[model samples]
Target: MKKNTEKTVNIWDRLRQSDGQSAVPTDQPWPKIWQGAEGLGQDFEPDVEAGLKRLKAKIHAMPVAGARIRRLTPLARWTRTLAAAVVAGLLGWGIYLLVQPATPVATWAEITTQAGEQKAVVLPDGSKIALNSASSLTYRTDMNEAAERQVQLIGEAYFEVERRPAQPFKITTRQAEVEVLGTSFNVRARAEETTTEVEVTQGKVAVHHLIRDEKVVLAAKEAVLVANDQPLVQETSPHLNRQAWRTGRITFRETPLEAALPLLEHYYNVTITWQKSAAPACSITGNWQNDSLTEVLQAIAAYTGITVKQLTADTYQLSGICK
Candidate 1:
């Protein structure tokens, strides 16, 4: 279903003709005159009176329109030679494409972590990435010249990118592009967080908003929160939480129940919510260790007095008293 343009056909023909009966060297060291006539599909006749006499009487009689066949001229013979070169190069490129296997489509690497498990990955370029619990990153294992480093992160990860001065590393999502050069950062793009969050622990990064055509640069200890219709880059405050799931723990400092629910689900792989009437106003203030799902839920219920209801393998319902 690929279209072979006239240009392509002509180039192939020239390559074939140039091969002729004699076995040409694989090196293809065509004369400069032949090299010059590349794309124009020009033909060449030898100079010198005797060569021209033979060309005019024989194989060179018919001239392909718009293509100059070298005539016995003291004038513009070089023009036709240049055209020949152009055609040869195009043919060579075509041959290369035909002989070579189709390039493989790029895809992301798959990474998964068990409930309490973590992993560290050293990328092809020597960059180090750590994946946290219940997290995964998809990226191309093969690095090519066309695209440097590109990966997609789901859940949370800590990246220690290797320094590649010429190639800029890029992390892409459904909404944004995070560009960096040899920096450490944590990215959390959870399905629960309403927004994709990127926090830089060291070095500098630029986050570009895909929809708004906006770009924000973050320094060390800075973070950007990107959500649908809302994108913000703010100086990280002291009250800010840890972004790395592997090393740092999540903390709730009198935060509302609704705000804390998403984090709990992400870490424990279980869903927890609140009864309608008590949900918005109920606040939670406590430090939860890396405890089991039941223990964490019990602590929350002890503070707010809301009953935790388990619905299925992965779903839960919160109801009853909050006051």
Candidate 2:
């Protein structure tokens, strides 16, 4: 061991003293030292020239000393591309959220009434609505001078809209759309019925059909009926009892019994079936208010000489002939 140590020290000393281009002295006992070192590992073989060539090539490829050359494989390149895309998407989404307009959330105020019930509501803009039985009125809570004042009605209602020429009041129904600057009107848009009726008692109103897209302008005391797939029919003299539900006043000026029966049924929410095959040429005329259904029926029976019988709770039968 001592001899081998001395030989290794001598080899290192000579390597340090020799210039890069100088060759080791052939006279030195180099073979004995190498042979002695090889005995320590019988399978060890040295390829000094090939190892030096590989190290030199690696150092030459580097941009600077001790700096590693990192080559990006296909998978690494794809990962980097995906990361950039994700970052770009995040930035784009952020920009979009910042620049996009905020959508306004609508706040609604609704009033509904059941059968044989009634309700009245005053809007924020001073418009009044009287909802009849089995009716509903829906409007936005934020209706003001700056916003559009629009209301949706189902069934029957009487509207006394305040005059706002700048922002016209609009009423939307199932079959018709009524727009007016200011008006007192009655709208009957019953769900069970396909036809919608709009009567303007005061001011002017523009009625438009939803299905046919036909339009008609109604003055005071004018009315229009909008039916599905039907032309716009404007009435110069609308029914007198159009607002009877709201006012509780019904007037029949020589109205035929056949026509008056339906009006009575509507006003009292009763069903009257005529038993006779042919209706008599009977006419009724009077103004009544705050009268019971029985009193009204009795009056009609006395005037037309028709027999009124209570068949059921809400169903009634009418028989006999006109006096």
> Whose TM-score is greatest here?
2
The model with the greatest lDDT is 2
Q: How well does candidate 2 score on lDDT at residue 216?
A: 93
Total clashing pairs in model 2: 0
Instruction: lDDT for model 2, please.
Output: 0.86
What is the C-alpha local distance difference test score of each model?
A: 0.74, 0.86
The TM-score measured for candidate 1 stands at: 0.60
Output candidate 1 Cα RMSD.
28.5
Residue lDDT tens for model 1, 15-73: 67784654554346454335454546556565699977887888667666898655577
Shift in Å, residue 255, candidate 1: 0.5
Off by over 4 Å in 2: 1-101
lDDT score for residue 315 of model 2: 91
lDDT by residue (51-127, candidate 2, tens digit) is 99999999888687586769999999999999999999999999999999997787888899998899888899998
